[model samples]
Target: MGVKAWLSKPLAAYVHKKHQSWIQNPVEAQQSVFESIIKTAQHTAFGRDHHFSEIKTHADFVEAVPVRDYEGLVAYFNRVKEGEQNILWPGKPLYLAKTSGTTSGTKYIPITKDSIPNHINGAKDALLSYIHETGNSSFLDGKMIFLSGSPVLEQVGGIHTGRLSGIANHHVPGYLRTNQLPSYETNCIEDWETKLDQIIEETIDENMTLISGIPPWVQMYFDKLMQQTGKQIKDIFPNFSLFVYGGVNFEPYRKKLFESIGREVDSVETFPASEGFFAYQNEQHDRGLLLLLNSGIFFEFIPTDEYFNEKPTRLTIGEVEVGVNYALVVSSNAGLWGYSIGDTVKFTSVKPYKLIVSGRIKHYISAFGEHVIGEEVEKAMQRTMQKYPMVELVEFTVAPYVSQDKGQSFHEWLVEFSIAPANEEAFAKELNAQLQKLNTYYDDLITGRILADLKIRALPQGTFRHYMKSQGKLGGQNKVPRLSNDRKLAEGLIESADALNTNKN
Candidate 1:
C-alpha cells in the first residue's frame, strides 16, 4: 500500500467507529447535538440576538427556527458585506462561498471556522462511507481528482469569497494533498474555455485514481480529454477506481460517463452545499445515506408539501421515514439557523438513513434522470447563446412533456426573444448541442434517441410577460421556473408559448 493508503486506514477506522455510533442511535445523537447547537448559537456573538431566540428544547428549537430559503440568507450576508459582524456565527467569517441563487442571481454565503469543521468531517464520512460500501480499501491510496467549480476567490470589499468547491480544496488535509494536478486555488480561471484548457494541462498523464465533481463539469472534462488524447479515460487513468460526485444528480450522466471510460467504476454521490455536506453515498451505490455532522450542526427535515407552500414542519432525524420527500433544514455553528438549502430528498432506508435525492424542491427538473436544474441549464444556455450574438434570449423555460402517443416524456424549451434568428432551426440545434456537450447524459439521451423528443419554441418579445401575467405572477420575486418537472406545468408553458406565437403572427 502507498503511504497515503497506509495513513488513511487508521483514520478511516476511527471515523467509522464514531459514525457507527451516530447512525445506530440517530435520535439520541440528534437530540444531544441539538442541545449543543443551541448552546453554541445562544453563546456565540453571531448567533446571539439574531432573528431566532434561544431554542429551549430540541422540539421547541426546531419549531422556533423556521425554514429559510436562499433569499433570506443573502439578505443576512448582504448585511455582513456592509461590515455587520456576527451575522451567522461568532467572530469574523473566514470567507464566503459564492453560489448562483434562484431568485437573487449570485449569492455570497458565509463560512466560519465553526462551519468549516462540518464540511471537513462530512467529507471524511463520505470517504469512509465509500470504503465501507464498495469494499474497496484501495481507494484510500489512489490519487483523487475533483472537477470542481472555479476556485478564483474574488475580493469583494476586501473580503475574499468564491465557490465552496474552491474553498474546500484550500482546506483539505495538508498531508493528503497531492501535487499531481494544478491546485484549484492557484489555477483559478472563470472562463470555461480558459478553465478547461488549464485543467487539461494539469490532468494530462496524471495517475489519478478517483474523480469527483458536479456531473456536468466532470462530463465536460471527460469529453475534452477524449478529443485531445484520442484515448478513453480508462486508457489515461488506468488506476481510476471511484467516481465521486455531488451537487447534481449523476444518473443522467452515468451512462455517458461509463461509455467514455469504457466501464462502470465505483460511484459515490455526495450532497454538499456551501452550508454543509449533507449526505454521502454509502457502500451501496443505489442510495446516499445521511451522515449528519452531529459534532458540528443540527438537522431537521420538513415534509415536501410543507416546503412547496412555504409552511415548515421541522422533523427530527429519528422521525424521518422511507419513501417520503423532505426538504432539508439545518442549523450549524456557521450561524445559519433553520436554513433550508432547497434540496428535496427521500429516504430509501431509515435504519442507516439511506436517502435518494428526489429533485430540487424549487427551480429544477429531472425527467428520465437528465436532472437539468435551473441554474445548470441557465448557465449552459447563457454560455452557448452568447456564442451567437444574434440569438438574444429575453427569457426561457425548460419543461418536461409527455407525448400523448405512448406517454413518453421529453424536454421542450420555450424561449422568448427580442429578435428572431435568421436560422432558428440551427440555433435550436446548437442549443441542444451545447446542453449535450455540457452534460453527457443529455447528449446520450438525445443521441441514443431514448427520450421522447427535444423541441424548442421561439416566441415573441413580450411572451414571457404575457405568460407570467396569465399566471398572476408577473413581477417581483416570481421568475420563470427553469426546469418544470411537473407534466401539467410543462403543458401549460407549451400552451403559453403557442398563445404568444399566435398573437405575434
Candidate 2:
C-alpha cells in the first residue's frame, strides 16, 4: 500500500469511532458542549450579564438565552469588530466571514480559533466517513480541487475579513497541501472568471481524483473544461471518482453534472454553511445528512409555523421528531448565542439524527441554486425602477421556467403594474443586468446557460387582489409570495391575470 492509502485506514477508523460515540449518547454530548462553551466564556461581559453562574441545566440555559437573528447579535458583533475581546468568546476572532443574511445589509460572522477546527475537522471526518463506508482510499493518492471564494482577505478593524473559503485557504494542512489543486496565487484571484481560467490551465493535466464546490459553479467549470479540450471530464481525468457538493439541492443539477462528466461517479452531499460546518453525508443516501452531534455547537429546533410567535417552542435534539420542518438554532464557540441562521430543515432520521434541507424561513428564489434571496432581487428591482419614474409596481412574484420541453429555460417574473414602464423590453433587460451585478452565482449561471435570461409578464393593477381573493386571503395583512421554486404560484398569477384580460374583452 502507498503512503496515502495506508494513512487513510487510520483516519477512517478515527472518524468511525468518533461518529459512533457521538450518536450513542447525543443528549449528554450536547449538554457537555453547551456547558463547555458557557463556562469558557463565563468571564466575558455577555456571560456576566446573562448570569452564566446560575445556569446549570438545559432549562436554565433556554430561559437565560432567547433565539435571535443577526439583528439581535449585531450589537455584540459591532463590539467584536472594534477589537473588543471576551465580548462573545474568550478572545478576539482572527477573521470574519462576510455573507448575505436575513437583512438587506451584509453580515460579518466572526471566526475564532475554537470555531475554526469545526470547519476543518468536520470536513476531514466527513470525507473519511465516505472512505469508511465505500473503502475508497485511492482518492487521496491524487490532487483534489475545491472551487471556492477568493482568498484575498480585506482587513477589518484589527482582523482580516473574507469568505469562509478565504479563511480556510490559509489553514490547508501540510499533508493535504501537496495534494490540493489550483495554485495559491490563482486561488487568490478576485475575479471568478479569471480565476476559473487559471484553474483550468493549471490542473488540466494533473491526476485529479476529487472535485468540490456548489453545483452550478462546478457545472460552469465542467462546461468550460469540455469546450476547451473537446473531451469529456471522465476522459480528461480518468481517475476522477468523487464529487463533493453543498449550499444547494443536488437533484436538479445531478443529470446535467453527470452528462457533463460523461459517466457516473460517487457523490457526497454536505450541509456546510458560513455560520458553521453543520452536517455531512456518511452513507450512500439521498436527502439525509448526519447531524454533527459532537461538534462544539449546541443545537435547537423551532417549528417553522410557530417561529414568528413571541415565545415559540425550541426543541432539543432529543425532542425533535422526523418529517417536520424546523428552523435551526445554534449556540457555538463562535460566540453566537442561540442564533438563528434562517435556513429550515426537516429531520429524516432520529436514531443517528439525519436531516434534509427543506427551504428558507425567509422567502427567496433559489430555484437553480443561485440562492437569490428577496433582498437581492428587491434591491435590484428598486435600482432598475429608478429610470422608470412613472411606473408603480402593485405586486410581483418570480418563478423558474424549468420545462425541458420548453426550448429556453428562464426566470419568469409576473408583475402587477399600476403604472406601466415606457418600454417593457428595456425594463426587463436592465433588471436582469442589475441582478447579475448583485449576485455572483446568478451571473455565473447565466453566463454558462445553466439558466437563461429573465422574462417579465405585465399584469393589470388588481391582479394581486383578485388572486388573493381566490385563496380567501384578501385585504388583511395578506400578501403574495414574492418567490417560488416551482411554477404553482406563478401559474396561478398568470392565469388570474389572463382572466382579467378576457373580462376586459
Candidate 3:
C-alpha cells in the first residue's frame, strides 16, 4: 500500500466508528439535522415565507412548507438566478448545479456553503466505509477515474454554475487529486464522445484502480477499451478492484460490466442528486443504501400510493415502514423546503434505516392502468437476462405503445443489445412473462385482454447512444427513463432505430 492508502486505514476506522453513533440513533440524527437547517435558514426569504421561525416539529414543517418540485420552486429560484442573496439560503449560494429540466429549459439548483460538505462527505464516506469494511486500502494507491462532466464553470447570477459532477470536480480532496485521472484539459472537452476518447487515451496505460461512473457510460468506456487494445479491462488495469457507480441501477449492467472486466470486483452504489447526497451503500454485502440522517438534510416520506392525493400522508424517519414505496421529500441546508426530488425509495431496514431507490415519481407507466415502475421493469429484465446469459443489454427503455388501428395497445420494450439472444421470440416472451409476474396489474391487463403482450423492439446497437446524443444528453448524469407513460421518447427512439436500419439496408 502507498502512503495515502496506509494512512486511510486508520482514518477509515475513525470515520466508521463515528458513523455508527449516527446510524444507531437515526431518528435523533435527523431531528438534529432538521432543527439545524430550519434554524440556520429561518431568516432567509424561503424560510420566512414558509414560517420556519415558528416551526418546531416535523408536523409544523409539513403544515408550513408544502411539497414542491422544481417547477413549483421556480419563483424563488428565479430570484436566486437574478443575483438575489438570501432569496433561498442566507447570503449567496456557493454554486448552482445546472441540470436539464422537463418543462423548464434548464434548472439551477443551489449548493450552499452549508450543504457542500454533505455532497463531498457523502462520497468520501462511501469509499472510507468500503475501506473500513474490507480492509482493502491498497486500491487507493492506484489512479482513480470518475467519468464525469467538465470542471468548466460559467457565471450564472455571479455564482459558479455547472453540472453537479463538474461542481464536485472542483472539490476532489487534495490527497486524491494526485491519483485522479483524465487530465483537466481532457475532462474539459465539451463533447462526451471526445471526452470519453480522451479519457481512454489518458488512463489506458495508467494503474487505474477505482472507476466511477453511471453504468451505461462506464460500459461504453469498457467497450471502447476492449476495441482499442483487444484486451479485457482486467488485463488493462490489473489492480482495478472497485467499481463505484450511481445514477442508475447496476443490476442490468452487472453481467456486461463483469464480462468486460473479465472478473467481478467490489462495487458501491450511491444515492446522489443535484439537490443533495441522500444515501450510500455502507456495507459490501448489504442490499440497501444507508440513508444519511445527519447530512444537513431532513427527509420525509410520502407513501407512493397516496402521493397523488391532495393531502398525502408525510411520515418522518420515526414513522416510515419497510417495503413500502415512498416519494422522497427533503428540506435541507441548501434552502430547499419540502422539496420532492421525484425519487421514490423503499426502506429495507429500519434498524439502521437502509433503503433502495424504487423509481422516479414521474418515470412510471400507468397508461393502461397497469402502474408499472422502473424497479419492476428492472427486476424483470434482470431475471430474464439471468436466464439468457448470452443476451448482453447495452440499454433499454419501456413506454406505452397505443395502437392507432383500433387494436389493443401494449407496453413497448426498446432494447439495444451488445450481444443479441439466439431466439429473439423466446427472449421477448420470457421478458414479458417476468414483468407480468412482478406486476400483477400488468399481468391483469394482459390476461383480461385489455392489452396485448408487451412488445420488444430490438433496437440496433448504439441506437440509444445516438438518440441521447441527438437530444444533447449524451453523458454525465443524464440517463434514459426506464419507464414512460407517453410515447414521446419511445417514438423518437423508434425513429432513430428505423433510420439506422434504413441506412444499413
Alpha-carbon TM-score of each model against the true structure? 0.75, 0.92, 0.75
Candidate 1 off by > 4 Å: 43-54, 132-135, 139-142, 184-186, 308-311, 365-396, 400-412, 415-455, 458-482, 485-505
Error of 3 at 162 (Å): 0.4
lDDT of 2 at 261: 92
Global lDDT scores for all candidate models: 0.70, 0.85, 0.87
Candidate 3 accuracy as TM-score: 0.75
> lDDT tens digits, residues 1-505, model 2?
5698679988898879867877989888898898899899888878887888888887888788888998888888888888888898888997888775545356789888999999988788888999998999898999999988778898887889988877888887888899998888998886677788899998899999999988877887887898899999999999999999998777777887898899999988988877899999889865589999778899999999999998899988999999999999998998888899888999989988999889988887776767777777888789988977788898888888763333446788898888889899999999999888888667756765667789998887788888888889998888777787778888888788888889998
Best of the two (1, 3) by lDDT: 3
Q: What are the candidates' C-alpha RMSDs?
A: 7.8, 2.7, 14.0
Comparing 1 with 2 on lDDT, the higher-scoring candidate is 2
> What ranges in model 2 sit over 4 Å off?
102-104, 368-370, 401-411, 429-453, 460-466, 469-476, 497-505
The candidates, ranked best first by TM-score, are 2, 1, 3
| Superposed Cα RMSD, model 3 | 14.0
Give candidate 3 regions above 4 Å deviation. 364-505
Ranking by lDDT: 3, 2, 1
Error of 2 at 94 (Å): 2.0
